[model samples]
Target chain A: MELKDYNSCVQEWADPLFRFAYKCSGNEEDARDVVQNSFEVLWQKRQEVYADKAKAFLFQVAYRQSVDLFRKKGRIQYTEQPEFSGSSNPGNPDLKRVLERALSQLDEQSRALVLLKDYEGYHYDEIAQITNLSETQVKVYLHRARKTLKNYLVSVENIL
Target chain B: MVTLENYEEYIISYVDGALNAAELQELEAFIAHHPELRSEMSAYENTRLMPDTSMIYANKEALLKQAPKRTISLGNWRSYGVAAGIIALIGTAILLWQHTNNNHVATIVNVTINKNTAQAPVGPIAHENPIKKDKAIQQPVIAAVNHRKQARPGIASAPGINRLTVNDHQNNTAQPSQEKPEVNKPVEIARITALPEPKTIDTISPAKVLTAVITPNETMVADKQDEKDPFAWLPIDDTKKQGLKDLKKTVDKTVKEVRSVTNNLKETALVFKFGKKEITLNF
Candidate 1:
């Protein structure tokens, strides 16, 4: 990719990549670091990447740095804890906060898969490409993660 | 296909928008048959996270890149033209300087020749002592030439040496005839006859005289050859012609040096100034 195309990728994909990294790593600082590193890798390999595939390439880098690296470093740490606590309290009825808590509950890989699927709306194959997983694995993991989230939301709804 | 065993997969795919029209209809029909599962599917749909538009990456300007620097090459026609013009100008200047220096040297040579010719006595002078005749003839002419040369600093003294030698020879012959009246008449007559005719020296042009002074032996041979060949009207000395060729070679070498300097300049960075901004392009 040319410099202009790479810069355009930065402008277009930086926010989404940051959000994906943030959701996957559950830390704003780590998310920012992931975004910076992903763009840096993209710039270094700009010649090898095409402008059309730049977004996917960036997401792939972000996914590996945020999910794989964080997992390798041990269990995930949330610098900013989600507002919702897993409790039977009906006062906290915010569905978005409950969903955030639910998303934090999933493993890093599954969370990255879910973020890649829902936030970026990538297909199973594209998510597999980004996460370096088979299409079957992406589908199975995403379904499992969706069930976990649905169960959490159901329990919260029952309490409400 | 949307049975209870595989119902969760269909519900996830439905929420993910992965279900096509037929799969959607099948899942909806299955859900209609199981009204309790409708809320379950709705819970799965709520799991799809909407990206917070407010959670944008701040300072996007930091990720942007500037365009890479471009290299300038010497292939430009303007650069070639400038180099050619510089070489030509340098060559012209060298040639002009050489021409002017040659003319100046020739002028000095002619002035010395004219002065020597005018000062030397036409008639022979007799010397009292034969031993002193040789020294007297040599000393005065050399001293006079040296004194005249010293008067005009930086002029070449080589061209005047030959003219002074001829003048000393004339003086030596005159010494014997004037100082020794008792010497044999035949010997005195032969000595006078041996001397070159003054008319011959007066008749020869200054340019030929200068050529004769530079290469006396070669000039004499060429003169003898000219006596035989009818077409030998222009008698050119080989050494003088070689000197001119050497000067031409020097001018050519100077032009080559100028060309090399210009080529080196092409390898350096070209800087252009526009008001306060300066752009430098490297080759």
Candidate 2:
């Protein structure tokens, strides 16, 4: 895409990407960094990037940079096993906190895949492309991440 | 019968809409049998929907404020490098200029002394003395070196010095200072004796030997031969005596004159040519 087109695309995607990044990163500052850095990458590679796929590219870039920030700070681990437990009403405030904590507990790629799929309503193929995984892999990862959040919510309710 | 693992795989595919019609029906029938698995599915769906509650828009203004907006795309570090390069270039130019200036001054002084000394005619008194010649050579060398020092800048860098192949010449010329003891003693004497003595009024001018005296000094000392007061008015040379007689007869001019003498012979000549003009002496 040319600079003009990329700029208009940025205007369209900036808020949504920022909203997702802010949710993922848990802070306005880091969220903005992720979003701005993603736009910068898109701007730099504007010529090579297809205009139709610009939205996916921007979100992927932001998610990846946010993941890198999490890894570098050692706030997230890469190899924890997900736990699944059956529960009722996982969206309550206490269960929500438990689920958010469990969501944070998942690996960055799995967390991003789950968020993109379940929250953003992205297709499995779209998630796979954005996360550089196969469509099957995206489904598997999102399933595991969702199951872990569910188990943590149920277990936390049992404790309460 | 569909197993629990098969059911879970089928359910996962169902969530992704990847399962075909029969597989979706099987997943639905399996979940119907398993109430706990059905509740897990509902929990997963709720978990998936929940992150949006906390989702917030990133504050772009705060991010931009913290990250320092760039006015110029070139970095500060690179600008510093450019500034350093310019300073280095200026320093090199200054060094080169100083070096060339010094060499030019040295060359000029060397050539000037060489030409000037060669041009002057030696007087009879100095021509007879071998010591005078030795002294003359020594004195010129000191003057040449002093002039070279004043004219030659020591700090300047010279590229042409190598290409011109003047290394041996420079070494040889610089070598004389190493033998300065021998050169120094004679140089002092040559400088002192070769210099013309101060003149007295009693002595006539040496104008007859040369063109008009461009740097005439009445105080300049004439050649010192007179010691007694006999015929003190007599001109220093016979050529001057004839010239004065012819001048007095032709112009019939009587000129007031003052002459001081310690001997009969006047120690100075009456006429001399210096350059393009003839100058005659009256006293």
Candidate 3:
């Protein structure tokens, strides 16, 4: 890629990618790290990247980086800490807060599926491409993930 | 009754929108008949509207810290190596070149359309230790142009030794005949500049030059195509574009009204209401 062109791409996609990374990792520094690594890899593979394919290219790099970190930390397993207050207090008036806490209770993959589908509003095909899952699998994962979150939210309400 | 275990797959498909029209109808029918499942699905959708405070993973920084720090330094070295290679190649070409050295000198002269222009000094010789004199001379010229392109516009302002020496030579050769007229040219250029023209040096800076060179030709073509096809660059469908245009116009009108009221805040604040509370601006 041309030097100026790459600079423009960084400007356009850096913030959104950082936000995505921040949501996944829950730390600003790690989000920055993911963004930095993503750009570094993008620059290295500049030859393979065309202008139109640049967004997918950066996203793929970031997704892989997030997954790699996730695997390394053994976060793929299902676990939670009752000691923690979770992402929100049980008294928060906003139902959105309740949903967000419910979402965080799920495993990394499920959380990722929910975020991609609901928040970023990716189609099943796009999520499949990014997550390297089959379109059918994306549908199944999203369905299961959403159901789990729904169940978790209902449980929280019942306890209240 | 649809048991939760038997209906789990359908619930997922229903939320994910993978179901066909008939399937959707069936699911809706099931929900209509089943109050408990309907409540469950309502909770599912409420989860969608959740405020996302997802944080970037924390240990990612520590892991990245564990990785080598030399990547940036390595990249810098790679670029430096490529640049050094290009300089060496051009250096070799100059040494091997047998003729046409004067044409090269003339091309340098041709660059100055305005003869009396106060040219900046040429920069330092790029190839520090040249194997040959001819190569050394040519290397500076090629590198100067390349450097100018990459460096800031003001970088060449600090004239170099080579430029000072060249200026001395040009003064001796062309001085007597053109000296008077040349002295007056800067004054005339300065006078023309002083005129109250809307477009001046500020307007013709490198940014505008680059924009004129690049954007307009492409934009002109796009505009021509757009005249025949209105939705060319727009992502919205034609029907949607019409709706969007009307919406935009309405928004603009409302924004203008709001802005006008804001601009007259002191006067308008007398009548403004916010729920049960009302406040007045003293100014």
Query: CA shift at A41, candidate 3, in angstroms?
Result: 1.7
lDDT of 3 by residue, A48-135 (tens): 8887677777777777777677667654332332443554764644465556567667766666777666656677898888888898
Q: Candidate 2 vs candidate 3: which has greater lDDT?
A: 2
After TM-score superposition, the amount by which residue A12's alpha carbon in candidate 3 deviates from its true location, in angstroms, is 4.1
lDDT of 2 by residue, B1-283 (tens): 4678677656665665567898778777888888788876765555654445444444433322222365855685586557655655565466445534443122211111112223333232223222323344211111121223332333122211110112233333333324222222211111111222222111122212111111111101110111122333895332233223323322221111111121211453344444565544332
The residue ranges of model 2 lying beyond 4 angstroms of the native Cα positions read A2-4, A76-95, B16-22, B50-283
Query: Model 1 reaches what TM-score against the true structure?
Result: 0.55
lDDT of each: 0.62, 0.50, 0.49
Q: How well is candidate 3 docked (DockQ)?
A: 0.13
Question: How far does residue B129 in candidate 1 sit from its true spot (Å)?
Answer: 42
Query: What does candidate 3's lDDT look like per residue over B209-254, in tens digits?
Result: 1101112233223223322433336874332332233233334434
Q: Name the candidate that leads on DockQ.
A: 1
Q: Specify the highest-lDDT model's number.
A: 1
lDDT of candidate 1 over A106-133, digit per residue (tens)? 9888888888888988999998998889
Give the better candidate number (1 or 3) by lDDT. 1
Q: DockQ, in order, for the candidates?
A: 0.59, 0.19, 0.13
Model 1: DockQ vs. true structure: 0.59
Rounded to one decimal, what is candidate 1's iRMSD? Answer: 0.7
What does candidate 1's lDDT look like per residue over B127-175, in tens digits? Answer: 3223324433211111111222122343233332223232344445545
